[model samples]
Target: MKRYGSIIGVKPEKLEEYKKLHVAVWPEVLAKIKECNIRNYSIYYKDGMLYSYYEYIGDNYEKDMQKMAADPTTQEWWKLTDPCQQPVENRAPGEWWAAMEEVFHMD
Candidate 1:
């Protein structure tokens, strides 16, 4: 499995709303995540940033991501959650969250 990490800035004013939304994530979105071979998914909040970590078990990461993105349920989910986030200044083109390099891992 390949691990991924990313960061995005959360608006301070919307922090509670973001947290509340996550407390009961939509079933369809959760299913799509697993359907796309994403596991151990977690999102953490610190300061003004949201950090996401997940493991990709599928052979084709890009294709799985595309599938997730193309899902109507995920699209509707993003409509609610996207507004509470701000893309980091240095994120790659088309990235809503700035991907991070994993310099070291021991496990």
Candidate 2:
């Protein structure tokens, strides 16, 4: 499995709303994520910065991501969550969340 981490900025005021939405994530979206080979996913927030971590167990990462993005349920979920997030200034073009560099690891 490959581990990935990403960072995004959450508007301070919308933190509560974002937490509320995640407290009961949609079943379909969760299913789709698992179907796409995503596991052990978690999001953390601190000082307006949100960090997302997940492990990809599939061979085709791009394809799986595309499939997930195409799902209507995931699309709807994004509509609600996207607005609450902002890409960090250093994020590359076409990236909503700044990809984080892995500095240390143990397994």
Candidate 3:
């Protein structure tokens, strides 16, 4: 499995709503994430930024991501959640959340 981490800023006004929405994520959207081979997914909020991590268990990362993107439930979830995020200015082109490098890991 491959682990991925990403970071994005959150609008101060929307932080509470964002947290509330996450309190009970839609079941269909959660299922879609698992269907696409994502596991151990987590999102953390700190200092006005949101950090996310997940393990990709699929052999084809790109293909799995494409599948997730195509899921109606996932698309709908993004529509609700995306607006709460403020992507970093320097995020690479085509990236909504700036991907992070894992410099160290153990266990």
Candidate 4:
């Protein structure tokens, strides 16, 4: 398993709306994530910033991600979620959510 972390900003005005939508994510979207081999997925919000963590269990991360991207339900889900976000200014190239380096880990 590979652990990943990333960060993005939530537009202040859209914070409440974003939080509301997450209360009941569509079942199809959830299934797509599992089908792509992402597990232990979670998103956290704090001070206008959103952080995400997930473990990738697939042999090919990029391939699995592409598979997820090709799903129509996932695309529609992003259409709803993307508007509420602002990518971090210092994010690395090609990063929508800034990839975070793990400096420490316990078990």
Backbone N/Cα/C clashes per model:
0, 0, 0, 0
Local distance difference test scores for all models? 0.96, 0.95, 0.94, 0.96
* Residue 19 lDDT in candidate 4: 95
Model 2 C-alpha lDDT per residue in residues 1-107, reported as the tens digit of each score: 99999999998888999999999999999999999999999999999999999999999999999999999999999999999998899898999989999999898
Error of 1 at 76 (Å): 0.5
Candidate 1 residues 35-102, lDDT tens each? 99999999999999999999999999999999999999999999999999989999999999999999
Off by over 4 Å in 3: none
> What does candidate 3's lDDT look like per residue over 13-107, in tens digits?
99999999999999999998998899999999999999999999989989988998998888999999999999999999999999999998888
TM-score of each: 0.97, 0.97, 0.97, 0.97
- Please give the lDDT score for candidate 3: 0.94
- The C-alpha local distance difference test score for the whole of candidate 2 amounts to 0.95
Which residues of candidate 4, in runs, are more than 4 Å off? none
- In model 1, which residue pairs have backbone atoms overlapping below 3 Å? none
